[model samples]
Target: MPEYPTALGASSRDSITLLGKDLATDVMGEVGFGELAFWLATQRRPTPGETRVFEAVLAALADHGFTPTAIVTRLTYLSAPDSVQGALAAGLLGGGSRFLGVTEDCGRFLHEVLVEREPPAGDDGWDELALEVVTAERAAGRFIPGLGHHVHKDGDPRTPRLFQIAREEGLVGPHLSLFAAIGRVHPRVLGKTLPLNGAGVCGAALADLGLPLELLRGFALLARTAGLIGQLAEELRHPVGNDIFLSVDLNNRSVPPSAQGGPHG
Candidate 1:
């Protein structure tokens, strides 16, 4: 017989247990989902500040209009209207290095910076360390993750607001500070206006919140799931995926119908 490793579990027939606690009596209504998420991930309850930071990060990344994930979700639904779970899974499947996966990349980068830096001596020390990290990354031909965006050219509007909330909660730390310092030196180092992006801030903030680097990106996945659900709901009402397909077909009408594929059933 094979043994299964498990920490999170549930027992059927009467009541359920999660993290060794009674689910219905100890958790179901007593704590908010954000707090529950923390407990589930860490196997311990979060402090008030930790909960606030976790929830804020989740809320901040929850959605962005017409993102690829949302588009894929809608298209999947068009192909199979009856499977809501399938549509949501299709959207989530788009998460990777180019998209939501960048959360993990950014988090790991910041973690590396923190690991390499000496204990802070003064304000100048942090700036010097941040500059060094940026310079090395640039020299290696690494396009720094979480620093630039295709849209929001001037700057990511979410960055400042997230920092502000972190400040209020006293959750700001070396990772967040170093990320911002790097942004200050960005124009000088890169000779371009690569502003700090939301994912960068999220990575830094989650680092400061003491989340493991491996789990940092999971927070983003969870947030985007909620956003995809909302998008799927709206998609059902407005129904644009078929129209988009038609538009593409109409524009490419010059191609021989034979090359487009056989007739659909």
Candidate 2:
């Protein structure tokens, strides 16, 4: 007989194990969802500071008004009308390198820098290392993940606040310090100051807390699931998916011959 071993869970007569811990007595309702997520992903309990930072990250990413994911979910819901799970999955499916999934890349980038390079001695040392890293990324034609934003040109409001909270909780570490240093040198290196995006900030913080890089995107996905649910609820109240569908459909309709490019070349 062949058997597979599992550390995450197994059902029993009277209890269940999750990540090698008692699910009913140790976890159920006793911890916040964010805390539980961290535990399940890493198989270790989070510290008070880690828990606070994780919760903050989840709250920060839970919504972003009419983002592509929300729009896609609404449109999918309009088409299917009854498949809420499908709509949610449709939205999540769009998460990739440029979108919500960038958090994982950002975390991995920071982890590589922190793990492979010697810790910079002070501000100057950190800045120098940041410059080296940024320059190499640019040379490789890579946009630094977790830096810059489409709308928040000057800075991402959420990032500084998150950093402040982390500092207050004494959760600051080399990963975070290096991110700050990167921001400082970014303008000189890239000809524009790239403020830390919210996801990037969370990535650095999570990396500092010793979380696996693979879990970074999962956190973003979980947080955005809440945001998507809110979007769906609003969509139910104020229906606009039909309008969107109609607008797109109308735009794509074939133009009459007279209306095609001023009627003549």
Candidate 3:
């Protein structure tokens, strides 16, 4: 027989263990989902402050009202009402560069920048470093991750709130310090101010929490899972999927193939 080792969860005939604790007696009702999630990822319990910041990140990413992911989820549910899992999976599959994936992208990007240098001494140093980073990225023709938002051109409410929460918790580590500096200084290089979007800020906060850079997107997805469920529930009550499908289906006009290659061509 072969043995597989894991510190996560194990099951026996009569009992179950999670993170080395009895799942039913120790984990259930004793740990909140957010804390349990944090524990599951890092295999160590988080402080109360860490839990608050982490849960805040989860809340920040949860739902954004009629996003493509929500739309796809509702549409998938409409198409296959028999398979709720399929609907959820459809939405989760949409977590990519333009959407929830920014959480991971920003975290990894900030981590990479931090790995190359020491922590800045203060906001002034961070701003100077951010200026250098923005200038280099501009020269390279690369967009700074977590810098802009499509909807909240003025500002992302979640961004500042998350920053405040992290600050209050004394959890503003180098990643967040750098991200905030970027928010303040990027306009000098980019020639315009852009709101530091919520997803990007969540990334920074998670990075500051020392969460795995690779699993940053996973956290975003986890948050959005609740949102997707809400979408599906609202879809049942309000039922917009059909109207959405019809709006596109009825409005689209058939045109001849263009000189440039097209999907039909």
Measured on C-alpha atoms, candidate 3 has an lDDT of: 0.96
For residue 89, model 1's alpha carbon misses the true position, in angstroms, by 1.3
TM-score for predicted model 1 compared with the true structure = 0.90
What are the clashing pairs of model 2?
A: none
Clashes of each: 0, 0, 0
* Alpha-carbon RMSD of each model: 4.5, 3.9, 1.3
What overall lDDT goes with each candidate model? Answer: 0.85, 0.86, 0.96
The candidate with the higher TM-score, 2 or 3, is: 3
| TM-score, model 3 to reference | 0.97
Per-residue lDDT value at 58 in model 1:
90
Off by over 4 Å in 1: 1-6, 253-265
Off by over 4 Å in 3: 261-265
Tens digit of per-residue lDDT, candidate 2, span 1-265: 9988987889889989888778888778787788888887888888888899888988988888878898999999998979999999988887788678767878888888878778889899999999999999988998888998888988889899989999999998898899898999988878977778988888888888888787788888899999999989999999989998899888896756664567364
Superposed by TM-score, candidate 1 places the C-alpha of residue 227 at a distance from the truth, in angstroms, of 0.5
Candidate 2 error regions (>4 Å): 253-265
lDDT of 3 by residue, 127-155 (tens): 99999999999999999899899999999
